[model samples]
Target chain A: MERTTIDLWVGVFVAMGIAALLFLALKVGNIGGFEAGSVYTTHANFDNIGGLKAKAPVKSAGVLVGRVTEIRFDNDSYQAEAILSLSSQ
Target chain B: MGVSTRFFFLLLLHSGTCFRRPQLILREIFSSGVLSLIIILVSGLFVGMVLGMQGYETLQTYGSEEALGVLVSLSLVRELGPVVAALLFASRAGSAITAEIGLMKATEQLAAMEMMAVDPLARVVAPRFWGGVISMPLLAAMFSAMGIFGGYLVGVVLIGVDEGSFWSQMQAAVDIREDILNGVIKSTVFGIAVTVIALFEGYDAPPTAEGVSRATTRTVVTSSLAILMLDFVLTAFMFRGV
Candidate 1:
């Protein structure tokens, strides 16, 4: 019974450790790249969207400034227009 | 065929028969899949954290810290995620498999199975082979996801890169198909290579504890080397058109 209890604690500790690690990792890595506040909009037209998805980032000079808030076809130009929201730095 | 040619042919046939049993291979692959997933998730987080820190530091030097998203995404998706996960798997699970089978051989369990009219090849080898095949891509995906998360945490929260800018940069700079596919393809090949080498070494182990230990070490070392070599080959092929 004692050994089983110890084992249970060990499992709990491991689970907590993994969770903590994941939290820290996600906090530090910024993998999802979601941010709050600071919204400015811009547009871009692309011939092929390919795998581009909504909420994808908008980059200028190799730096990320905003995310794509909306995407639609510009019938006049026959191009995909991406509306991006830039953050205030 | 001449006598020499016949002898060579026999050797080839035996070698082929020893390793290429699909059912046995599949079983091994299934087991490897579970093991590989755990390793990949853990390693992916670390890989992402490291990439974020290093990329941030470098970008800061040039007053371009906001490029962290692009750097982390590209590096994780294209290169670091799969390779680091593969290395971790090679060190952890690859060594374990080699040692387990090596010990079995040393204890004559393999011979016992043969004596009992059981095919050790079918029973022992197949599961691990298939396990590796199934596990590798799953592991790679976990690694990629964790890595991206790690970068997000550091780049946005710690450095205060404005959440909007950080994500936007990542989306604009990263070509999802290119980055994600690179990792998947590399991981699949790495899984096969690790499985084959570990299984081969385990089965070929000498009948002693010392021999088993040596085989385990060799499996780890060789699998790591194989991953690196194959990474280069795969990268070359992947980028040839680009």
Candidate 2:
């Protein structure tokens, strides 16, 4: 094959590969959160957290408000605490 | 093993020259990565379809079939994309490289290049090595992307699963760093391991027809085994906390 033909094809292949990575990142992986959105954090204490975990969806009245950033045992309060990162939107 | 290690470092020492002749590397990439795209994409689609079907079968038992997206994406991005793509790359590009080099040696082309004051290591071997390395991770990424599309086709479009839940649940569960980054890291590691093994086996083969055939076989077997072993080690390190 001509060298230019080879170069053109190689360029296409590399471009396709990059496009695939982008698709994985933006579309499939959904890494777009919190990039432009401003967020605020708040704390809530519960006697039992049940199965609530970090990054769990925080729903208010059946709508997603934000996510749980951290779930920990409160040494002082003798209860479980959840740090919620709520989006301004 | 000792001889192969020496060959590997020598290839690395000569790697700089491959960049100087950009066409050499480009040609190798064309032959390795571009040619292999069809198989990677087709195989990815089939694998994803199977995952969707199986995922639906199991999840429908609990009436939780919407999580099919999560299952397919996680499995492909986390494991199958890197592992299966690497295996296909090894068999397709890796073996081709080894066989080509072995044939050149058998035909004394490498020696002729040396006679003409050309460093075959620089002019020939390095480009192929770097080419495989560059091609591998890209191929894996394409594999993962195609697999996801395939799963969407089968799971949502055909099977009547809730499209919104499919994507939203996958997005919620699959993190950029935790799932996707770890996968990219895995494929890059596989790329290096596969390229090095393929190059070494070819360069070390005896200059004879039978030897060349044996070298090609060894390239496939060794690189496949190396990929699997390295996958285990990498998964332990990358996904331990998950």
Candidate 3:
């Protein structure tokens, strides 16, 4: 009886640990940036994006609408080009 | 010096053989791990609550209170979760392991086992070592989970940070492979270091009551220092690109 009880508690402990890993992978990490459907890519030219980097969230009125997929400099136009991928949502 | 070196080698040798008995390892895991788990869970909760409160106040100043979840979860998952849990493990479980083994040594139980041709290192120390190593990562994970829940309680339920934004922002910001996995790796390294130090100190302690107490104290102190030192090195390596 005692052995089974201990086993039960240990099993719960291990389950909780696995649950935390799952949370990390799914919620916090979001794993491979999984999104439903497809994302729409839009290009915009900017004078300077400052410290903006790829994968930065694109927010509209304090709501996250999309992500910056890529950033590059257009030397001919002397402007920064940012590629944004907006979720279908 | 020669005797101590030989003893170290014996510990290394028996560590391999100790896994043969699953029952004994399970018993040691119960004795050495459960208390640490309880302590770490409570600590993690409180830490997260405090973080939620503090983050809300600070971010609210900048009109960014919705980011509380990101702040709390990222902090706990990336750094505080593994590091603080390991420290708690060192103080609670690590000290206990040292004291238990040290007491056994002081009472000449180890000597008796040796005289009977039983390898004390294998029978006594190795199981405890493995028990601790197995426990640390699990304990750290539980700590981070409870911490995230605590943050949710404080930020969403209490302070009224937009529940959706808190979780969604956190999910968007944190990376599993980069942050969480690295945290696990950190805790695992700390587990090995803390347990190895605890077992070594206990096994090498002078067979006296005072000696046992000193060894227990050494286990806590050395484990804390090692955890912090190793955290820095691991962080530098893991976050090198970022």
Q: Top model by DockQ, which number?
A: 2
- List each candidate's DockQ score: 0.06, 0.72, 0.49
Candidate 1, residues B45-158, lDDT tens digits: the string is 777778888888888889988788878877876787678878887887788788888888889899999999876666665556556655666666667777877778877877
Residue by residue across B49-156, what tens digits does model 3's lDDT show? 999999999999999998898999889988999999999999988898889888988898999999999988888988887888888888888899889989999999
Q: Report every candidate's CA lDDT.
A: 0.70, 0.89, 0.84
How far residue A29's Cα lies from its native spot in candidate 2, in Å, is 1.6
Minimal lDDT window, size 10, model 1 chain A? A21-30
Task: Tell me how far the alpha carbon of residue A60 in candidate 2 is from the true structure, in angstroms, after superposition.
Answer: 2.9
Off by over 4 Å in 2: A46-53, A71-73, A78-80
TM-scores, all candidates, are: 0.65, 0.94, 0.85
Q: Could you tell me the TM-score of candidate 3?
A: 0.85
Per-residue error for B204 in candidate 2, Å, reads: 0.8
- Please identify model 1 stretches exceeding 4 Å from their true place: A1-89, B1-39, B240-242
Model 3 Cα displacement at B13 (Å)? 3.5
- Give the per-residue Cα lDDT of candidate 1 at B201: 81
What is residue B202's positional error in candidate 3, in angstroms? 0.6
Where does model 3 exceed 4 Å of error? A32-89, B1-12
